[model samples]
Target: MSHRTVNFKGNPVPLEGPELKPGDTAPNFRLQQNAADGLGDATLDDFAGKTLLISVVPSLDTSVCAQQTRTFNQKAAQLPDNVAVLTVSMDLPFAQARFCGTEHIDRIKVLSDHRTADFGRAYGLLIAEGPLQRILARAVFVVGPDRKIKYVEYVPEITQEPNYDAALAAVA
Candidate 1:
């Protein structure tokens, strides 16, 4: 574990992995997507060869997280089919599905890391302590078609939103 730190509000907290940067290979992950019958599996390989905008949030219930997901949903809907948008969080698949239905989040895929914090640990966004322990840090990653990171933004404060323009531009 890299155990890097990032500020949450005014407090500093440890994270579980290295702070990723552009040109790095995007880490592989196994996450869950909601299905009508039950939770379905999703993996990094499922998105192979597509440009991806991964919006990471601590939870969708928070205001900033909701707004961040909604912002990306709208932005991504206008993008080409080869570009895909995903929002990963600690929320369960059922909760994520409920949020998507309530928020009209059809343009993007809202995934769950609650089963296992694989995405968080892999991306270095897993909060390691304090009130938010086990939750993912607020961040954004743009993975190019080659599965290399094209952009990375770790929001300095967990309550804040990421740079929408910069991430969207990375996809363009």
Candidate 2:
């Protein structure tokens, strides 16, 4: 399904929360893995003392989102061992697992926000209206080993890819 149409090549949309910036502390999140019961098995504290890259996307079923995840999976392998990457989306866990299995996405952890949209709202990347309403706007956050955000990029265009170089640099 189309995440964004050609007509909406680049349009501003309403978002839900405060836009996080560098030096801001990354919020602790407990995201769901294989269930939609509104509970999470993975928490931010799980990666304590490690650099974390949170890649937020609308839906993995879409082309841009899929490519973004795949790109990060490749990039993750080259990152420092202390760095952990996560791809968050509203897609159900089943679909996410299937996508990872088919695409050989083994490096980063792919989690679902369909449970509570907690991650989206907390990160201020939730599209509150438009065609992508209820979905997450593309964003990347790099949290340092101290859990402080070292970089933040809220991709202006919903349909476009994020700045991989900038995010990767922040991790370094």
Candidate 3:
């Protein structure tokens, strides 16, 4: 587990796994998605040969998390077609699908880590303990086509928004 800590409403909480840094290869992860056919698996390779902007959130039910997802959804339109934006959370696939439908989110892909916590553990965003136990911390990662991370932001405060401009600039 990583020694990293983040705040939630000014309360400090520990995080698991080593914090990822720039230049490091983005770890591969499998997330679940609710589809018309049924539940499906989405892996890092699904976006191979494209730049990936990953938005990590604890849950979409929260205001901050919803905003984060919506923001990236809008931003996805401006990015090149080869760039894929994904919103990952510990929420159940059913909840994620509902949120996207209710929020009218279409541009970005919403993935669930509830089943395995694979994304959370691999990315080091899992909140070890707190009221929001087992949830992910707010963070963002931009991985280039080659799979090397170009930008990373582990937001100090989970309630705040990530640096959208800086992350977008990295892709541009």
Q: Could you say which candidate leads in lDDT?
A: 3
Return the clash pairs for model 3, or none: none
Per-residue C-alpha lDDT of model 2 across residues 74-164, encoded as one tens digit per residue? 9998988999999998888888888999999999998888878888878887776767778888889999888899999988877889999
Against the reference, the lDDT scores of all candidates come to 0.91, 0.85, 0.92
lDDT of 3 by residue, 33-136 (tens): 99999999999999989999999988899999999999999989999999999999999999999999999999999999998877888898988675778999
Q: lDDT score of model 2?
A: 0.85
Model 1 C-alpha lDDT per residue in residues 1-172, reported as the tens digit of each score: 3457788887888899888999999999999999888889888899988999999999999999999999999888789999999999999898999999999999998889987787888899998777888999999999998999999999988888999999999998
Q: What is the C-alpha RMSD of each candidate to the true structure, in Å?
A: 1.2, 4.4, 1.0
Question: Candidate 1, which segments miss by more than 4 Å at Cα?
Answer: 1-3
Whichever of 1 and 2 has more TM-score, that candidate is: 1
**Residue 6, candidate 3: alpha-carbon lDDT:** 92
The superposed Cα distance between candidate 1 and the true structure at residue 139, in angstroms, equals 0.5
Candidate ranking (lDDT, best to worst): 3, 1, 2
Pick the winner on TM-score between candidates 2 and 3. 3
